[model samples]
Target: MTAVTDQDHTDHTNHTEHADHAGGQGHADAAGDDTGRAEERSENAASEEGTPQDGRSTAAGPDGEDVAEGPEPAAEAALEKSEGEEPEHRAAGGSKKSAAASAGKHAATGPEAPAKDRHARVQADSEGSWDDGLIARRVTEETAAQHVPTAPARPSPPQATAPLAYDGPLRSRLDALRELVGLSRTRLDSRTLAEAGRVLDEAASRRRLSGQHTVVAIAGATGSGKSQLFNTLAGVTISETGVRRPTTAAPIACSWSDGAAGLIDRLGIPGRLRRRPVQSAEAEAQLRGLVLVDLPDHDSAAVQHREQVDRVLALVDAVIWVVDPEKYADAVLHERYLRPMAGHAEVMFVVLNQIDRLPGEATEQVLDDLRRLLDEDGIALGEYGEPGATVLALSALTGDGVGELRESLGQFLAERGAPARRIAADVDAAGWRLRSVYATGQRTGLSEEDRDEFAARLAEAIGATAAGEAAERAWLRNANRACGTPWLRLWRWYQDRLDAPTGRFPARAQVDEEATARQRVEQAVRTLAERASTGLPAPWGQAVREAAVRGAQGLPEALDELAARAGLPPGRPPRPGWWPAAVFAQASMTILQVVGGLWLLGQIIGFMSPNLGVPVLLMVAGIIGGPLVEWSCRMAARGPARRYGQEAERRLREASAGCGRARVLDPVAAELLRYREVREQYGRLMGVPAAR
Candidate 1:
């Protein structure tokens, strides 16, 4: 009989426990109605008696007598029932097992066979189906999962995005630099754009280290011995120095090890890149990034060399001016170079080089005097609370105070690095000037009014009055040539009347006076060309008149003097030598014609009657005599005609040469000078250092 039934067990009861297992057969019977089907089937199989129940068996029915076992058959039928209900029953068992696992221990042991089956069934059941309570069970199961061994987490790969490429800014900057490079051709009048290009390149190169390097140039007048100081500071024979006034014709480079290549290259010095390691420990440490330039003398005869000095000076972070004892007070140096450089107050150093030549005790006095002169020149040499312009007495040959000079330079470099900002300012100023000339709303060229002024000046210099006189004289000569001799004198009378309207011909006294003909010419020139004031104080007005007289006096006197110098007579020849020859030939021809006619008449009479030949001879003498007398009168008139022509030609040549020199060439040259002055002034206003 079955002890318990499947329906009798609660769903929450532990399926793996002994009671569940012991009553397993009873519960199996309740689980299904097919309990004896296995035993009946087992008895029908061909089998032997006393077979183990662990083995499955079947017996034959009526055809053969294979008997079935009764007691084992009952047990097998119950097992079959439990086996049929195993899936639901195992689900029940799994819940109990999970509860036991979470409670920190196993709940119970069980009947060996059925309990093992139940446990196995439970694990398989839990994986197949989700119960409503499994989520809460999952939380407890999650804790158990943590105890279960887990694989370690793997690292992620690096991110993959597109590469960064240069945009327009860099290319645009490069384009601007290219433009500047192209502008090198414009270097003679304005290298500002090219300078700006160099500055841009330098800035870009040193963008990260802008405040670290200093470039200083030593610039001064010719004979100032700037090169000597340069060599002394550099501690090398970097700059050529000697008796020649301007030894450093080009910029010289002296720099420390760091970035010296760029500095030298920017200054456009090639083949001098051998780096000079700093010798002094202090200088080596403090002035690691300094570029010192030994610039050409500012007052050099070579304009381009001077220009190079000015250009490099403007771009440098600091300046050291070398001055000589003799010309330290020169107006040209102070006015043209130094005074205009007054804006660069902080970065300037003034050195009195070769001070050893002066008296030992007089150096200080001279320094004081020099400082005072600088002050007068609108330079504040020493101001309180300011880093005044440094004054050093140095003998470059003797190396006197050279150490001090180096120390000062090093200090300056340490404090104020290269003039990157100053170069930018200069570029900006130049751009402003160019913009003025090349403005957006306006076009630039020589204006009509200016052209008229220039033309007027040119006309005046040429002596419009003298040209007009020459033209009138030409008309007179042509008229006289065309007109009969009687009409020619009438033309002369007309000229005299016209002359009366003008003042009388200048006298010898007036021409030789203090304000002479030359003075009048110059005054006319000055008025037309220079715009000298007609209204002036007494002496200056008189002085202008005197200058005019001097200029005017030169032309006529020049002709006369040239003639005198050549040992020719003071005046033109009275007549051309050809005039007398022509007259003599005409006289000879007329006499020959008259004599020929007389001889023919005498021959004819002699043929007619020999006595009549005497009368014919008298007739021939009368004819010849009349012709000879007439020839004498014509010969006498030749002198006056030749004199007139010679004088006219001389006057024409003199007047024409004077007008061309004074008016055309002089005015054109003056205009060129004016253009140059204006250009220089514009450069000055714009703060362009100097064109290279």
Candidate 2:
């Protein structure tokens, strides 16, 4: 571009624009050379802009009139700027021509002094003239002009807290999802996978565990004293408590440590109330990592409040489900939350709140009834149960069971890994839900018998049997053409040609390549799919059926192509070492017969001495031997031809079956294998040997 500017417009003002816009074209024109273009842009833009706008007189033409723009401020400034950039434009070893053009541009942009003085100044500054001075000065001034005063460096943006790293339980859950997402949604229970995915995302986003915080929520139905319980546990009024039906309208959190700010922020619990527990007791110190949240009533009339409870419930590490004696065994709580969260029983605590309101015997009864409901819900209870969940009777109002509850929370918090355990349980539950998809009580892979049967069906479909019979006939026909008795061989060869006017034999046998064949292949595929899908769930069965017929498109054409390419089992019977002997024996027999007949005729006609006995005996022997030789040759051809036919049949069947395997059976097997793999991955995610 710069070179084009140098050649087209002698003015140096467009140097930057030309170099940027047409650099490639210029380089191509310059034969991959750039130094010449750069030098021209620098020299021409600087030397030629001697305009009146730049405050310099234009150069005189032969008539002494102004020829071009003179050194106005802008012109002089541009010329000087270009001159400063001249050295940068030059290559390490610039050509003499470039240097000359630069020197000429320098001389043209002379100072505006009187003629004699101007000449003297040009001579004085020839080594570093006004051309160089002006270029350097302009370059410096423009560079300075581009500099803007940097404002007090703007304050940095608020740092965004990245979500928790995916590892351990989160990683396992994601890995299990690999198979679940790929599985047939009809069988794999997509709802469970979706829920598990949401849980995984929650774990990643909250990142409380990494923040050294364990978020334990206190959730219960209305009038369950949940907010009061939360306050008693924290030893401060963190949650609003009143006689109001819905005391807590949102999820209020209380962090026992300073590091839980990020955790609280992520939970979206900004305004209700937050407090730090005083370490007056050793238990409080032990509970330092705990961040307790008092959730809105699960059965609240407001949908938003209920939604808040649910949202907080999923994200929390553990739960203390507060229940009064009146609603201790409420089916709503069990069916909605406890039953679904059975896998997370280890982190759950079902507290019989307001125990102070009940008599000793009544309190025991309510606790037992709660236990029964929990058991029925499949929640493993900690006391006298599976040790996965705990049952406690407490009065947040009276602080009766609060101490024991606090101690439990302290111990759970000290473990410093409740979040991981909770996340793992979530994954386990999802895996359990999907168990039917994988654990169908049967092997998932295709058996050899199944494969062989399918292949056989395909072979039948493509008419391998007919092709084999054709191959046998072809081999036999050729055999007779070459090996029969000499006269018969010629006659048979001619007879074989009678059917071939153009001397081109028909195809041994053509595959039907019709819908019947396709239907047969489909049937074989369906059968194989049915067998493979035994004991599999309905969705997987359907999937297997679909997979079995995955590549049905253009199947007939594929079969035809394969058949055409698959030649008959090679059998050139004449190539055998003994075949020549058979032909020779037959030929010899014919010769003997001819010779004996001729000799016999001579004796009968009395052309020679009487030797009728020799001639007649020779003739008889020759006749018998010729028949024997021909019969032997015929007998020899039968075994090889039969064997060859059978071999050809086997080869054709194999080729046809192979095509079936590639186009149909293979895809079906892949689907089954995918199911198996997902099942295995789910098992691993659940931390089990296999899906139950």
Candidate that would win on lDDT: 2
Residue 328's C-alpha lDDT in candidate 2?
75
Per-residue lDDT of model 2, residues 1-692, tens digit only: 01111111221233333342343233223322233333345455546663332133445421233333223333343344444333322211123333333333333433221222222222222212011011111011222222221111111233333344546656766666655665545444556568656755765665533546688998999999988887666553445667888877777676654446566666677532444332234534667668788899999999999888887777788998898988877888888988988988989988888888887599887777777888899887776644588888887776787778878888778776677778777667666766665566665667898888888887787777777766666666666655566777677668767865322212524345476777887777778878987877777777877776676656656776676666463444334456788778777777777888898788678887877777677667767776677677667777777776677678768788878778877888777777777777766766666543
When superposed on Cα atoms, how far off is each prediction in RMSD?
A: 33.6, 26.4
What's the TM-score of every candidate structure? Answer: 0.34, 0.68
lDDT of 1 by residue, 247-322 (tens): 6667766664343444455566543322232233455565566777777877789999977876666556678888
Alpha-carbon runs more than 4 Å astray in model 2:
1-192, 206-211, 275-286, 384-386, 490-516, 538-543, 569-574, 596-615
Q: In candidate 1, what residue range of length 10 has the lowest lDDT sum?
A: 130-139
The count of residue-pair clashes in candidate 1 stands at: 26
Local lDDT at 121 for model 2: 21
The alpha-carbon lDDT assigned to residue 5 of candidate 2 equals 12
